[model samples]
Target: MRLFYPRGSDHEVTRLVRSDAAAVATLHREDFARPWTTTEFDELLRQNTVFGFAARVIGQPKAPLAGFVLARLAADEAEVLTIAVARAARRLGLGRALMEALLRRLHALRAETLFLEVDETNDPAVHLYRRLGFVEVARRPGYYGGGSEGKSDALVMRLDLGKAPVSR
Candidate 1:
């Protein structure tokens, strides 16, 4: 999970498009040790069950995104692929906004549950998820690459949107 960069309500979240893939890739490059390529993002977007939203400062619709959330759906389940926020935007509530938007979208798609895996060390992310009503469902040992020659555990979290409130 990452912070969405724009300050205040200056940002707006909208459905991501194929043209936004490069910009999203740039974000991954800046935020992740191992970044995904534009082609990878394109492929993910091309999938029928995959969709995402991009956050950008209003009035600068053409500007690179401040953050984005990608997810994939299968039947009643949806998994958050990743979330990235620009370095400039951390500790703000943009991440929460994106996730609220994500949950709403998933609910519209009839997703019964949402799942995501976050690095155990991301306290902010874990806290956010918990506060959003996600619970620890499982743990994946060494799922993320980092620390001690690229090895870190991941906490699997789940939110039962069917029983939770989602903003429209």
Candidate 2:
């Protein structure tokens, strides 16, 4: 199990595994409207194309995760499926660390590009992606429902792996 600390963070980034399904599912429910189930997470974790990272407090390996990121890689492309941090853990750099870990793994795998769709109204997530060098590529109107303003547009963002991330 490869585990490392992201610079300036107290959390450890570790390889996500099948047993993490239940914990990640619980975390997912905190942020998503229609959260994925543990069974769904299990299936995804079993897939060869899917991989992810989980963040946990240093020295507390058995404790609940602070955050996680799930992604799928096919050929030279990768797409983030979902990412979530516990409400209590927000602003502690867990989300950014999970995403950065994914990026580093994708780079090592020689992935050419990465893509993700985020709710346009999610300012924090949008800003995080922008800081990571992701740019808007397209949009899907009413892609998500039941937001404060009813439905919301989804912003499709892309990052070319050849370029360095924008310095924060």
Candidate 3:
């Protein structure tokens, strides 16, 4: 799947390509406590059940790779592996754009629900997911590690796509 913005628009989302490995790795490293290597990302791209995407500003150099979202489909469920926006790109709707794109793809794949685990202390991401209709369903203690604050709890959130309200 693909999403495009008119020329000179703020951001654009596109299907993940092998050529995106370097930029993606850079974004992930800067955004996550533990980032995936290019080879690891390549392996993920090779998986039949995985889908990935990248977001970029219209005229940015080096793509900046503002953000990316990854998910794996199983039966009727899709689990978001990770979604991260660069520090410089937060609050610009790149994360939301990537998520909307991912949701559209999951809908196309006939997914009934989406699940993810976010750091309990990540107020910004938690707010975004909640705004997107994801509800906290469970918690995993000490799910995140090696941050400035040490280990943090993980909140498992779910979005029931099967029953999601449709916009008029």
Candidate 4:
């Protein structure tokens, strides 16, 4: 699908293009403690069922890849595998924009529910998901490993896309 953002803006969100894999990988590595490699991204793109996105700033040749959202679709449900924004881009609303675009894409695919797991200690992400209408649905012990002190629990969140909430 073709995505367009107004020109001359400081930032813009665009669909993940074929050439974005490398940049995405770079951004992923910079943003996450553990990042997926370019080969992994290539496989993901070939799957034809995963949706990814990238946010860029205008006039930048390398488009630092402020953030990205990766999701998988099965039948009528979708799960967000990961979403991350570069450390410097965290407070710029890139994560929220990436997720909103991803959710809209999932809705078009007829997904009735969205599932994701967030680190229990990630308050900002938890708050963002809550504001996005995703509620705590379950918890998995030791879902994350190698935390500051040790392994940590992960909180599973879900959003029912079947219901049209007044807020976006």
- Candidate with the greatest TM-score versus the true structure: 2
lDDT of 2 by residue, 1-168 (tens): 655676677789999999999999999998887889999999999999999999988888789889999999999999999998888888878788889889988988889999999999899899889998999999999998864669989999999988847222
Ranking by TM-score: 2, 1, 3, 4
Model 4 residue 41 lDDT score: 81
TM per model? 0.89, 0.93, 0.88, 0.86
For residue 17, give model 1's deviation from the true position in Å. 0.7
Best by lDDT: 2
Report every candidate's CA lDDT. 0.84, 0.90, 0.81, 0.78
lDDT of 4 at 118: 93
Over all chains combined, what TM-score does candidate 3 have? 0.88
Off by over 4 Å in 4: 1-9, 146-148, 164-168
Between the candidate structures 1 and 3, which one is better when assessed by TM-score?
A: 1
TM-score of structure candidate 2: 0.93
- Kindly report which residue stretches of model 2 are placed more than 4 angstroms away from their true locations once superposed: 146-148, 166-168
Models ranked on lDDT: 2, 1, 3, 4
Across residues 6-106, which tens digit of lDDT does each residue of candidate 3 receive? Answer: 23448788888777777778778876767899888888888899888788776664657878888899899999998888888788777777787888788
TM-score of 4: 0.86
For 1-168, candidate 1 gives per-residue lDDT tens digits of: 222333466787888888899999999899777899999999999999998988887778778788888999999999999998887876667787788888888888888899999998888889889989999999999888766668878999999998766554
